[model samples]
Target chain A: MGLAKRIIPCLDVDDGRVVKGVKFVNIRDAGNPIEIAQRYDEQGADELTFLDITASSDKRETMIHVVEEVAGKVFIPLTVGGGIRKVADIRKMLNAGADKVAINTAAVANPEFVKEAAEKFGSQCIVVAIDAKRVNAPSKALRWEIFTHGGRKETGIDAVQWAAKMVNYGAGELLVTSMDRDGTKSGFDNELNRSISDLVTVPVIASGGVGNLEHLVDGIKEGHCDAVLAASIFHFGEFTVGQAKKHMAARGIEMRID
Target chain B: MNTIAVIDYGMGNLHSVAKAIEHAPGNCKVIVTHAKNEILAADRVVLPGVGAMRDCIGEIKRLELDYIIQEVSKSKPFLGVCVGMQALMEYSAENNGVDCLNILPGHVELFDANMTNAQNERLKIPHMGWNKVTQNSSHPLWQGIPQDSRFYFVHSYYVRTNDNNHEAASTDYGVKFTSAVAHENIFAVQFHPEKSQHLGLKLYDNFIHWDGNR
Candidate 1:
């Protein structure tokens, strides 16, 4: 209730470094995760989250070092995700200093994982990350389906309804990444964003397809969600969080300017 | 020569914050530290973070950085960025319920799932990307930073401070949570000034030159 719309910059990590993939292909290294996170932190980023892309590889312990290194240098709330398939994994992440644990495929595979994590860590520490894609024809009943395995497989789960279930299972927040809008910058899938945000009780973070500032405003005011997440635009330094907030203010969207 | 020593907990990205501060006209010297002496003598203080609030808070306690922060912020220009900003809260409900510096009043809890509404669906977790910052009051940090100037955000939980007067900025994530706050000589933002490009650096510049009048 303090402000409207949040802007976030993401760093997709592979092998303890920052890397970006074009449609999850042709991967390119950005820099050391710690260094890159420092750069984003100084640019007036509200918070920092790390997605250990390699977490699925089962080298989970290594991500802790990454988190430790980055957390030591920067002074922001940091969340870590990827390969978080178990409550014990969540405990390890927390012990490693992660503020929140984001789980996707694992939560879907064992729905009880959501409830268990929530019961153990509190709903505030459990974040349900859903990777969703919009099919060609949008059916009113269930047009969006949950995609897992780095968004390669569809779970046939309704993005809207599944989000509600996560909350029921004691999810503190939802990080929704639009597979279609991801990295495209065509703008966020506002239709999907608004719908999910309107449906969920917990705060919803709209992800993917943020080419510019207007998209962020649309995601917050139009989408009526709690936060907006992006990468390329910020990673490339195309625009700063400050500029985007100014634009949002112009649109009458509440934001933290200074 | 009041220096603003940034707390280096062995996890965050500090170089960028330092570089951004140096980029600005803020005369205050910005230096990353795990030492106490540097913190005690500084005219201003800054804490920028990435990674876990639990770890940062732990390191601060482990290294006895909290006392230094409290001591400095009591009379000097104190600032916290990102997780650093959240550390200023009373406690973090994330990661084994970490106890924070408690410098700023209020606790930061995760977005309650039970709080979600049932009518909508679309947005998702991690709350990453760029978002607007709503200014609720006038402060030195806002001198040049335009209203709605976006700041990069990447956290799911936000600070829920109770003091309305301390709040300087707010961002929506399900519900509005305190984003930027000012208490006497202390000023903290949930956004990163270094990574925020020009507008964010401008705030840092303002923080450097803040006379504490506005």
Candidate 2:
């Protein structure tokens, strides 16, 4: 068998609790991060991503604690994203038992941070999260631009060029999130995913806008992503990770199915 | 209680490795250290490396862990992981070709940039994700582990031994590459057993009870 396509269930963690919102709005509490993480692991999630959406710095310690507890019990690869601004932040997360750290706004603010973090910690642990919004309509030439501050501020950077630049700056993986389709329960922007995936040599994780098992399949088959990350679909118990894997495997996608 | 010294040269997921060992079924004191004395005193030793081969080897030499690792590998139940596995080879094509510990007879090479699968699709580098590893030969470490089990892997470079007898397991990632290697008391793998979930913990448990024999 070859390298199986990964199915990652993302948990939007806020103050140590798991939360999910529609297009980054109307937040709702899911459950405890540790319990949710264990449940996902039991369901055969290939990997788990924890996006720390906690706004207050004082509450950030909760995220670290959550990572530590889950990491102690969960055996799969764990990735921590959000609020990672400095190398110290990356260190704390890694030391807290996170296998990888994803950087978004910080990388946009200072591209050098990616290089420095990758150098300090191996590139294998550094992931560049890109939040992209479509600049052109469905009929026009495909174009997407990077947005920061939870997709409110525009960086005026092309998503495709930014992805390649991050890889050059030593990003081991790219987490591409579609702003337009995120939480809409529609699907992933396959064009945007393919655009960034084809340009970079590192693995690209397609995130945001996963509504069904078919979307997971499209992320790999059409979007060309190495892995698919969904927050609501798996978090809300709409579909189990095992079901997603079986569906993807049946659709001719090589998945890690026991 | 046995002590498994996870040799720390300032690289790799030392926390995860130590934690996994502690969580394994076997009762052992897992310490993440670079002190030669502690490593020598331990019943088992683990060499874990991440990042570029040059950096991994550089830190091993800078910290003077090379001799310690060599000494422990001779008699102790030694396990190397990822770049740790590559570092056991004589040479590596990574970081402009660097010398390794040469504990095992092999050369580490990068997966071709243009490497494609049977479907003619180009595979990503690093080969990041869960891939099934086919056990090539029977060994103590393979005790509870199934014949073909999936393990978590995240690396661009792979090991190729000069002697086929050193290969313990293989995985197909476009090209069939050696995923695990065993030479006497030493066993090394390109995949991360600590991050590989239940099956991975089983491997660590097996390593703990291994007697460093055939």
Of the true interface contacts, each candidate retains a share of 0.12, 0.76
Docking quality level of the chain pair in candidate 2: high
Which ranges of candidate 2 are over 4 A from the true structure? Answer: A137-139
Candidate 2 global TM-score: 0.98
Tens-digit lDDT string for candidate 1 (B1-214): 7477777776545666776677676456778887888778776778877666776777788888778888877877778887888888888888869888888888877665543323343334445545678899988778877777776665667888879888888876667778888888888887767655567677888888765555
Q: Which 10 successive residues of model 1 chain A have the least lDDT summed?
A: A1-10
Q: DockQ numbers for every candidate? A: 0.11, 0.82
Best by DockQ: 2
- How well does candidate 1 score on lDDT at residue B207? 81
Candidates' C-alpha lDDT: 0.75, 0.92
Error of 2 at A222 (Å): 1.0
Native-vs-model 2 lDDT?
0.92
TM-score of chain B of each: 0.91, 0.98
> Candidates' TM-scores?
0.59, 0.98
On residues A108-201, what C-alpha lDDT tens digit does candidate 1 reach at each position? 9999999988766656567899899976465445378899988999888888889889998988788899898787779888888777777766
Candidate 1, CAPRI quality class derived from DockQ: incorrect
lDDT per residue as tens, model 2, B104-165: 89899999899888888888987899988999999999998888889999999999999999
